[model samples]
Target: TLRPGHAQLAQTARLADLEQRLARVEQAVGATPAKLSRLGVGDHSLLATAQHLASRAALLDSAQLDAAESRLTTLLTKLDQVAEKTAAITGSSDPDRDKKINELYELAKKTEYLSQVLPQTLERMLALQELHQQGGEFAKALSEIESVQVQLMAKMRSNGETLASVEEGLKTSFATIKSNMEALDGRVKALSTKK
Candidate 1:
């Protein structure tokens, strides 16, 4: 007689083995991009989201926060498209599978919210950049803000409690960044008036 725990362990082992086989198949097929293209799985909107992220990196490198924000905004649209396309591909025929996919879709929406908040945060950074007289302090603050953005992005991909904690962290970080930027803006303005 198999114990319940033993049965659960066996199920887990089977799942792991199946995942390994699926990965190998994907690797073999992925190596031949042209074949996949011909088979009509190419041009996925998910790739478009990746392309937007690449462009966002370039924008950030150039210190174009506003442009980066715009790019992220557009990426949100692409994310929506990808979610819908994915749902169409893996239709809601099975209740259990549909529930799992719905979670992914919800995550995408949350990512869009993060993207929206990111620009607002970056705008605050841009305002701080205008106060270049405090270069060192401003740069350090900017670095921290960017670090938060990275953390939030990573958290958005996580499941359950980690994701919830990161979202709350982002809210706090944004509030702090905004408050600091406002203070700096006021200080810069006062100094300019004195000059």
Candidate 2:
């Protein structure tokens, strides 16, 4: 009887120790990403909200000014949070964290490009929405936005790949990307003459 009780107590103690270890692991996992940590200790709620807003915008069938305005408002709010957190972590507007981070940057620049192109796109979408409201071609506006988005995505992906190839370090940085492999060669020639 005594041996059985001792074994049970030992098992219970082990369980408690396991729980404590799990809690610590959870904290470390939550703290791993600095930008996310800045937002809060363990709630990615706002970033999720922004993602939801973007999803909503994508699902929206028509380009009503009100809908676009709502999406823009949500995106701007989320961007503000991300920018604050990222700037705190990186200390610069452009933070080069890693290859994946570089990909994100390229993708973001593509979105910015879309934002620039959006006024015109929005105007077209608005016009089509108006046409739809009055019983004209409403579906076409959605198609146009989809097409532009697809093209924009492809371009960003291409740029990301290209940047990744050349951005490894001085080890991989090429003179060809500088408009001439011979540019360095010319510099070398000039240096030789000076010596």
Candidate 3:
């Protein structure tokens, strides 16, 4: 029997993860204008994260995936709507960046899937190795798994920096937009006062 608090904690962790993922997507989409134009170092992972979060909502369920699937689906739908609005403003000039972004997204999705699985596997393994799992050194040795696991974790982090860069770019864009709006509004007020 699972305690209520245990389930709540899991939900909290999962929601935090989902929110973090959403933040990454917002940052990526915000940076698309520049990233697609220049094809910078972190551009691949940035765009990939956005594409994955948009596409993967269908494969998840509320109970198992720990995402409120409906909310995610709605969020993706809103992104599609936004895309429709500005579809013509942005063009993917850098085909190589676009391709790399797709590849990165696929890799990120695979890594996320594995991360969700490995913990369950580790829990089962712990039960079997309990008595022998005592030594800190033994735990450390067990922690260092195969090369594949190491690679996945590294790749995930590699993606994080890209996401962070995207976020910064987006915030800067937002500030510019706000400043432009304020300028326009001030002009409107001046014109009205003259009238």
- The number of the candidate with the highest TM-score is 3
Query: Per-residue lDDT of 5-98 in model 2, one digit per residue for the tens?
Result: 8999999999999768766865765534564556443445444534656776676656676697899999999999998999899776644456
Worst 10 residues of 3 by lDDT: 35-44
lDDT of model 3 at position 145:
64
Model 1, range 1-195, lDDT digits (tens) per residue?
A: 899999999999999997688668667656355654554556443344346567766867755887778899999999999989988987756898878889999999878878879989999888988776588887899999999999987776676577688889999999999999999999999999999
Candidate 3 local accuracy as lDDT?
A: 0.77
- TM-score versus the correct structure, for each prediction: 0.20, 0.20, 0.26
lDDT per prediction? 0.79, 0.74, 0.77
Model 1 global lDDT (CA atoms, 0 to 1): 0.79
lDDT of 3 by residue, 8-53 (tens): 9999999999878877876766655455445433444554654656
Model 2 stretches astray by more than 4 angstroms: 1-136, 169-171, 174-195
TM-score of 1: 0.20
- Residue 57 of candidate 3: its Cα lDDT? 62
Q: List the residue pairs that clash in candidate 1.
A: none
| Shift in Å, residue 2, candidate 3 | 99
Candidate 3, superposed: residue stretches over 4 Å from native: 1-145
